[model samples]
Target: MTRRVLLALLLLGLAAGLVGAAAWAYEAWRDRVLEEGDRRGEARVQARWDEDRARAQEAALDKARQDAAETLRRLNQQQENERAQQALLAQLARDRDAARAAADGLRLRAAAYLDAAGCGHLAGDSALGCVREAAAEIGIALSRSAQIAQRVAADADEARSRGLRCEADYDALTLRLSML
Candidate 1:
């Protein structure tokens, strides 16, 4: 081939190589920009997801707090009911004890009355067997009366110690209970 033709062909080949290199560099730059944009888009989506998760967690926390408050309220109500029941029980017990004490006092008084009707100091008199029997009954009645009086006094003392006073003080505590 001619030298001039060969030189012209070499120049054309160099120009083609330059164009190819330029095209390859352009593609590489475009790919890098696209990768950067994809990374930025992924970061934005992740940030939005994190925000949504935080909001859901906050909502759950709020619900838990509400549930806890409700539980506390229910517990308080139950405790109040228990306290009321205990108070009622204590009052009933006090009433029952007062009634029993009053009954004892009345029984003692009745026995003493029966003895006064016939028995008393004439227990040794054999002329009237009935009178002797009455005297023995009187002795038993007096003893029981003393015991009842002691019990009544103790009950009044106990009531006072508990900060609950009986009417008429310690002496007539059972008498007031009998009226009730």
Candidate 2:
């Protein structure tokens, strides 16, 4: 009877040890699984964050490129406008010079006509008629000179106005660019 009891007790101790070892192995496995799951979740979150940051950076770069393009376009347009204004100013100068030359030519012609009328070598109605004709031509030349002078003045005024307008436009564009 003593030998039977000893054998039964040894068998029970072996069974308990195996159950305890199994329980410990199961706990270790559960901890490993949960840790792996946490690592995978952290990796997914990091990937999403990197993607979001890249997208935001790309968007900012795209906007910068667009803004640069717009600035370039405006600068080009401003240059063209300045060139056109300069051309207009140059043409106005030429026109004013031409009108002045015409007026001067008319004045010279009027003086020549008056000098021709000072012919004291001729006498009688024929000489008087020649003087009268010379005076009439001088009057016409003087009137033409006055008209040309008026035209020159008008052109000068127009050029001044255009120059002022160009200056104002440039100033406004500069101010707007500074704000940007």
- Candidate 1 regions exceeding 4 Å error are 1-11, 119-180
Worst lDDT 10-window in candidate 1: 164-173
Best by TM-score: 2
| Model 1: per-residue Cα lDDT over 93-129, one tens digit each | 6765776677667666765765676544555556556
Candidate 1 TM-score versus the reference: 0.54
lDDT of 2 by residue, 19-119 (tens): 99999999999999999999999999999999999999999999999888867866776777677677776777677778777777776776565567663
- Clashes (backbone N, CA, C under 3 Å), per candidate, total 3, 0
lDDT of 1: 0.67
For candidate 2, the C-alpha RMSD (Å) to the true structure equals 7.1
